[model samples]
Target: MADAVFDEETNVLLSQVDIEPVDANWFDIETDFVLSQFNLDNVLDMDVKSGNFPYSQTIGDLNVEANKTETGNCSSKRFNFEAKSSDVKKLQASSTPLNTQKNTRWDVNTWDDWGKWRNDRTISAGLKESAPYVLVPPLTVDIGAAELCHWMCRFILEVRRQDGSEYPAESLRQLCISIWRYLRDTCRRYDLNFFDRSKPDFADLRECLDARMKELNVSINKVKKQAKPINRTEEDILWSSVFSLNDAACLQYAVYLYACKLFGLRAADEHADLSVTQFTFGRDDVGQFIRYIGGRSKTVQGGIFHKKVLAKDIKQYANDSNPRCVVNLFQKYLSLVPEDGPFYRRPLATKTADGDQNTQHRRLVSIPYRSSCRECAKGQVLTASRLDTLVK
Candidate 1:
């Protein structure tokens, strides 16, 4: 009876299973179809017609033509294709990779600009054409330790803004570092011996930079007048004043100031980059809040090296009781602006009721703002300079 029951279960399971037989020639047919898509004859013909297959022959022909050219006679030795090819391959291997070349170009341009500035300054100072302090292209000149030190000292002491004000201590430090980096990179690229940290010159350079920086700081501090920090009471007064005003310009200013404080934004540029999409309304277990998703900033630049340093997501809870609540102000501001685009935009202008042709009033009007440039209508974002002016 047990054996009969087991057999009945096995038969039922087998009856439930359905298997379809595949054609034996299906694999062959599929393989043939894929192979047929690539015409070997056409590929070979194209390569031959394009003069690509016989790479060695093509290179030899080019070399022969080059040897017959007038510029080819400038070199003492005849053009050796094999040797030249090997050298080029080695250079390509040793040089900066294609992926990183974009960043290197910016550095190169900066270095060249610095060199030009140095030249201009030397000329203005009525120095001789052979002035040791004047900077030249790192790749073209071989800088010695003493020469470099002299140049750094002169640069720190002489370089000034258009208004003749001295550069800030931090700015001077960064400039020195950037120039050093350019020199170091040039040395590595051409296999030169200058600017190596292991050398005594490097040690002297470091000590000089440290000493100059300290001196600069002391001198700058003697004359530096810093702005007073806004106290909480002062802030309250300012906030109340801005909030009380029902004007469009005042509302925008309030929102900008509130956003800056809430988001812990320090630089004017950061505020300029803010947009509507960066903020979102969400509900948590406690209550409703406005969440801000941060991106690239002064401290946190998202890259492979900064993978561990995650972008910060900040939340500001809603305060219904407070008349000057950030959440309420933000919501009201959003309602006045478009659903998308920059957080801050140009204030709308409307004609006054008096019908004076020259009189116009600025107010919050909900409409898409267009850029002045006809070719591109997208760059309507508030600029850092304008933000600075507003803050002042």
Candidate 2:
């Protein structure tokens, strides 16, 4: 009525606001979409801007090329700790001196645009080699392949993020050996068969790793004359552990510990990681966790698989939480994990175990946390659900 008294045309325009648009975050992202899991009212401080993201197939037949689509959209999110975001942006702005951190320029955008820039640097270095090495002059392409090992080493054993808090630093020597094994297996496609002496890329590191592997095997033989070999299937036998999932609460932890003992999982105690999909309920509603594959799964045939789990025929299993200890663990620990974070993950103890003294120390001291995540999204996706007009 007041708007009509001042300006009738403006009032009509205001009244005709689209319901979806009015409820959304000023972007096309729907409130119903967010509200399906989180209360839209709980979120605060939103800033809208243009950003870029890519959508592509997770894995495809090598003969088939993945279709690529690049889109501009909202990129980052900040909930609490406004100061942390400020600090990062400030550091980004303060990058002044080019070639400051070694010949590497800070102007490298995307945080991953080091390809051409690094190639340019390599040639620049190769051109500066001294006289005696002229006959064996390094190729224009040089970024000490040893540094590649170090880059991977950091990934293998660096301090892992524990949901952005509480970290324990540890060396990744055994972890590197595991990674070396995986790389030696994976690099085969790129003509980098590290295990084969004939492959060109099979060089010093692979040879050393091979020798080290033999040495470790010999050492392990000397030490473990009586250790039982429990393969993955044997370990994941949860009816053997504190079994079943009758209670929504208790089944949660049993599922977690089963992952831990069976799959060498570490982060299942986190509730947010549990998704509607992970809860594979049978016709009888008997639910059980199946398997989680990594995004960079060589098994999945691509760089990343967006969906982590495969619904299997394992639901004929069990759901009566008899032992009750697992229920205690779930209530005391797993229940506290955010309802929207990654699902179960392998523990540091499992991933990095090899009789390393330091690893043992950390296992005794550090809390378990997952650096990896399985995205939690429901198959029953929410769309343009909106509030009724005039509360009718």
Most accurate candidate by lDDT: 1
Q: Write the per-residue lDDT of candidate 2 for residues 105-218, one digit (tens) a residue.
A: 221121123333444655767755663222221112342344453333223222233353212211123333333333333232333233456744446655555555565455
TM-score of each: 0.51, 0.26
Kindly state the number of residue pairs that clash in model 1: 0
List the pairs of residues colliding in candidate 1.
none
Q: Model 2 clash pairs? A: 51-73, 246-319, 266-345, 266-346, 266-347, 272-339, 273-342, 273-343, 295-304
Q: What is the C-alpha RMSD of each candidate to the true structure, in Å?
A: 16.9, 25.1
TM-score of decoy 2: 0.26
Tens-place lDDT per residue, model 1, 1-392, is 44654675465454455556888966675454666677676766678688878753444567788877756675546554456787976775444433234445554565566668877866788767575444553534466666766555555566665577766777666666555555556554232223456666556556666777787788885564443343455455555544432555556666765665667654544665667788888888988888889876656656556778877688999888988777777776676666777777665554234421121222223322112211221222332222233332
What lDDT would candidate 1 get against the real structure?
0.58
